[model samples]
Target: MKAWLLNDFGLDNLQPGETPTPTPKPGELLVKVGAVSLNFRDKAIVDGIYEPASVPKPLIPVSDAAGTVVAIGEGVTRFKVGDRVNSHLYSTWIDGAPLPDAPAHCVGMPLPGGLAEFMIIHETSAVAAPGNMTDEEASTLPIAALTAWYSLVDYADIKAGQTVLVQGTGGVSVFAVQIAKALGARVIATSSNDENLAKIAALGADALINYRKTPAWDTEALNLTDGLGADVVLDVAGGDGINQSVQATKAGGKIAQIGFLGGQTAALDLMPLIFRQTTIRGIAVGTRTSFERMNAFLNDHVIRPVIDTVYSFDQAREAYEHLTRGAFGKIVIKID
Candidate 1:
């Protein structure tokens, strides 16, 4: 089988070559991949910016994919051969509760991931794909969609009539807007691009802020809520945006910190946090259980993933480059 292997830490070291096909061990499933999706984390790992749970060389580097089961190991009763499935990005975190430590046995980092023709997944990590989605659409669910679902639904518990603010038009933010709306929350999306903002509005977002035009988007968001601020803020921007998120959140509101897309480090003011009793929670990818819940929601609501583009399996490097270039939605790789 041909797989894209990372011989060293840099993107320059990524090369395509033949590798042995993996067989399923007990409690594992061997999937013949149909498609794989790229996330910002993939770019970070390739650029040596992401540090895995453990240090090693020669890693297969992508977590999110959709495939058909070709074989299943002993004790695997949830699925069978010929079933279509997707693996959760964080394979070891099976529930919504916080892990005992950082680096929760993440796929594409410590473990071999989905960037190959054949990949093995534990039974615990597999979830059925949503009924209405194509393989390309289903591939985007494991990382971005699951992360958004965990943050908005599991952590924040955003409810109907609540105002939820989502930052930017990245993969997670797009999913956040959709899921928040699906949960009966009023969604407010922010984007630097007018085109993307228009697209977000079409996806049931009640309000849209062009962050570029309105440099003080946080204040505008507050004003839109009648000076009360949003009930929940899904924040992907990690630096000074944290301070903005805190300020834009209403008293006792929750902020789910999900990524460092803006910048990793930031100076924070604790005044709003102390006075308003704000709750700021850090969110990792998600648990396998959350992935299952998200799949159920997708199937019930007929939610479809937004894909920016699709690349052939052999064009994996180009797909990675496209993600780094800030594609508006999820980038997918057709593996079969």
Candidate 2:
């Protein structure tokens, strides 16, 4: 089998190598990987910046994948041969609360990932891919799409006719917009690029703000909602931007803290948070059960993942580069 290995912590170190095809252990499944999706975290892992002390050298580095089950180990009953499945990012968190060591058990970091032609996944950590989607489309669900769903549906308990504010045109933000619209919520999307804002508007966003033009986009959000604020805000940008999220959210509304593109550390004011009783929920992908529920939603809504680019298996390095260059939605690598 052929796979890309991160010999050291750098994009240049991610080179293709030969490895033996792995056999599934008890309660596991050996999958023929059809596609692997790149996330912002994948880039940080390659740069040795995301918990570098824990990431192992010569590791496979991608968390989300869509594949076909070729063989199932003994005692595996959840799925059988010839099933199309998506890998769960949190390999051990089956349902309910996450495991204490969920970060250590995550795929593409401490655990081997699906960058290879074939990879082994615990049967409990795999979910049936939506039948309407292709492998490349399904590959984006495990992290980006599920994070959006978990944040809006599970954390916020979003209702129809509510207003959702999503920041930027990144993978998770795009997914959030689509999912919010599918659930009958009005969407407000923010992007520095007017072109990207227009693109998101085409995807059913009720309002668009060019954050670059209007630096105080939070105020714009309030204006869009008639001096009230968004019912739910997806705060993909952390750091001082958290203050903006607090201002953009309506009283008693929820804010999903999903990413740290701005920066990790933040010194937020306590006054507004207390006054508004805003809930800032931290999202770390989601559990396997949540993934299954999200898949059902995708199937019901017929929501298609917005793919920005798809690279061949041999172009894994280029795929990572594209992630850094930024994209409108997800970037995928087809494992041929």
Candidate 3:
């Protein structure tokens, strides 16, 4: 089988080559990967910003993929051979409250991942692909879609008529906007480019803010909300952006902190959090249950993932480069 292996913990070490195909262990399934989706964490792993759970060698490099089951291990009954499936990005975090030790068991970091022709996953992590989606669309769901779903549906409990603010036009933000709209909530999307803003509006965004022109987007958002601010803010931007996120939310509103795209460290004022009774929750990629719920939602609503571009399997490096260059949607790599 062909796979992209990290020879070492650096960007320069990510190289494509051949590797032996893996077999399913007890309670695991072997999937013949059809497509793999790239995420910001992929870049962080290659750049050595996020270290793997343990120091290892010859690591396969991706977590999100959609494929058909080629074989099943002993004791597996949830799925059979030839079932179309997408596995959770973090296969080990199964159910209930997140374990304090989750970071150590994440896939793509410590464990072998999907950027290969074949990969094995525990049967507990595999969920049926949404009926209406293709392999390319399904590939985007395991990480980004699940993250947005967990934030909006599980954590924030977003309801109809509420206002949800989605930052940027990246994978998670796009999914957030679509999901919020599907749930009957008004969506406010922010983008640096007017073209991207226009695109977002066409995708059913109630309002669009060009952050490049309106540097004080928090004030703009507040004005849009008639001084009440948004009910729920999906804050992907970090650093001083956290303070801005606090300002953009209504008193007693929620902010789901999902990423540090702007920067890691931030100078934040705790006064609003104390006095205004604000809630800020940090979210990581979701568990298997969230992934299953997201698929069910997509199936019921017939929602499709917004794919920026599809690259051939041989162009996996190019796909990673495109992600680093900041594409607006999911970057897909087709295997078969």
Candidate 4:
């Protein structure tokens, strides 16, 4: 099977090549990949910035993908040929908390991921996608949507009438806005431009802030929420937004830390957190159960993933470069 293999840790090292098409063992399924989505982490892996030192040599990168089941191995009863599925980010963590190997067992990391013609994954690993979505849309779910859902629903227990703040217009951030609105919370989205702000509002964001224009967007969030601050803040900007997210959040509110788009580390003040009794959680993309639950929500709400662009499978390298430059919504690759 043809694949974009990471021979060395660099974008130039990603070459078009052929590897053996994997055969499903017992309790597994072979999927004919239809599309793959690019996340910021995929670019980091190619650029040698993502340090998951355990992945084996000659890796297939890009974690999230949607495909059709072409073959089912013995004891694989959950799905069969023709079933459409997406690869789970964590193969071993079926439910609940992260399993011991979950970090190392992630797709596009230790496992041969979906940027290939086919993939052999465990039957219990992935879940059915929303019926209304195209394969490209479903490809965005495994990481981006699941991360947003886990942060808003599982961690914060968001409710109606609450103000939820989401930073930037990245994949997880957009998904966070949609999920928060679906759960009845009023969403406040931040972006640097008027165009992205309008798009965010179309996705049900009740309030919008031009973070670039208004550097003190935290104070703005507080003002929008009637000086009470947000009940939940999805901080996708990492170091750049940590202090401000603390300021935007209500006392006893939760902050779900999901990405490092800004900087990896930040100097934080513990005094405000102590005084406000706020909680901060570091969210990794969630388990298969959470993926399934997220799908259920998408299916019910008929929420389509906002795709910014699509590239052909052969243009994988160009796709990586584009993703590194950043996009307003999820970028996908169609496997033809």
Candidate 5:
């Protein structure tokens, strides 16, 4: 089998190589990968900057993939050879509160992930893809989309007629916008570029804020909400901007901490929590239950992921480079 291996934990360490494909163990299934989606963490893993832990060497590095099951282990009853499935990022956490090994159980990290033509995962670690979704679209559900779903639906108590603020144009932010709109919430989307903000607006954003131009985007968001502030704020940036997020959030509103796309380890002010009574929750990607629920929501709403670009399997490195450049949506690699 042809696979991209991280011979070492640096950007230059990725090399094209061949490896033997493993047969599924009992209670496992072998998937012939049709597509894989790149996440910001994949770039961090390559650059040796991902914060969860140092890069695991000699491994395939992508968590989200969708493909057709070609072989199933003897004890696997839930899925068959012909079923279409996508990986559910966490191998241990099925649902509810996360476990201590949740981060370690992630694909592309401590375990082999979805950067190759085939993957053998435990049957419990796979979710059936919706029939209406293309492989490329299903490939995106496991990580980015799941995180967004958890932040908006599971973590936050968002309701119709409420306003939700999503930061930037990345995968999670875009999904938040789409999901919030589907739930009848007014969306305020932020981006540095007008072009991207325009695109966000076209995707049903009720208001747009160019954070670069409007340096005080929090104040702007508050003003747009008629000074009441946003009912929910999906803060993807974890740098110094968290202060702004707190300011942008309404009193008693919810702020779901999705990711630190801007930077990790920000100096925070606690006054907002004390005075405003806002709830700020930190979240990793979700459990398998969240993954399934998200797929059902997507299928019912007929919402397809906003794919920014697609590269062939051979262009995996280029896909990583493109992901590092920070595109407006999910970046996918299509396998033959």
Candidate 6:
């Protein structure tokens, strides 16, 4: 089988290579990967920044994929041959809270990933792909979509008419906007680009903030919400901006800390958190159960994922490069 392999910890090391096709063991499925989506973590892994000591060299590097089950192991029951499925990010996290060993068991890291033509997946670690979506679209769900869903639905228990402030036009933020709208909540989107903000508006964002134009976007968010602030603020930038996120969030509201695009550490102010009782919850991707629930919600709302670009399997390197350049939504690699 053909695949891209990371010979070492660098983007240049991710070159095309040959590998044997893997067969499923008991309670597993052999999926013919149709498409794989790139995430920030994928880039981090390639650059050797995300848990570099733990990453196995000569590994395939992509966490989320969608494909057809070509074969199933002896005990497999959830899916059979010919069923479409999406790869779960965590191989061990089945339901509820994530298991202690979840981080060590992720796909595209210690385990082989979807960059290959075929890969083995445990039956419990795969979910039925949405019937209405193509493989490219479904490939975006395991991390970006599920993170947004887990943030707004599972943690926040977001109700209709509540305000959700989506940080930017990245994959998770776009999904956050669409999901928040589907849940009947008003969405306020922030982007450095006005064109991107307009695009977000087309996706049902109630208000748009050009963070570049209005440097104090937190104050703008408060004004947009009649000075009460957003019911939930999806804070992707974890640097100094996190302080602004607290200001943007309504009293007693939640801040879903999803990404660290700005920087890893921040000098966070505790006064507002203490006074307002704001909850800053760190968001891991999500559980298998949460992925299933998100799929159902997507089907009900007819919300398709926003795809920024799709590269061929051979163009995997280019796809990673594009990810670093920043994407409006998701970047996918199609295996044909």
lDDT tens digits, residue span 77-99, model 6: 89989999999989899888868
lDDT of 5 by residue, 19-132 (tens): 899799899999999899988878877777775355566888888999999999889998998899998878888988989868877888878888888988789879999899
Cα displacement (angstroms), candidate 5, residue 264, comes to 1.2
Tell me the TM-score of each prediction against the true structure.
Answer: 0.96, 0.98, 0.97, 0.97, 0.97, 0.98
Q: Sort by lDDT, best first.
A: 6, 2, 4, 5, 3, 1
Over the stretch 178-201, how does candidate 4's per-residue lDDT look in tens digits?
A: 888889999999999889999899
TM-score of 2: 0.98
Cα shift from native, residue 89, model 6 (Å):
0.5
Flag the better candidate by lDDT, 4 or 5: 4
Q: Please write out the lDDT profile of model 2 over residues 1-336, one tens digit for every residue.
A: 999999998888889999899988999999999999999989989998899999988898899999999999999999999999999999999888867889988988988899999988999889998888999999999999999999999888899999999999989999999999999999999999988988999999999999999999999999999988999999998998999999999999989999999999899999999999999988999889998989888888889999999999988998899999899999999995
lDDT of each: 0.86, 0.92, 0.87, 0.89, 0.88, 0.93
User: Between 2 and 5, whose TM-score is larger?
Assistant: 2
Winner of 4 and 6 under lDDT: 6
- Which 10 residues in a row give candidate 5 its minimum summed lDDT? 48-57
lDDT agreement of model 2 with the native: 0.92
Model 1 TM-score relative to the real fold: 0.96
Q: For all the candidates, what are their Cα RMSDs to the real structure?
A: 1.4, 0.9, 1.2, 1.2, 1.2, 0.9
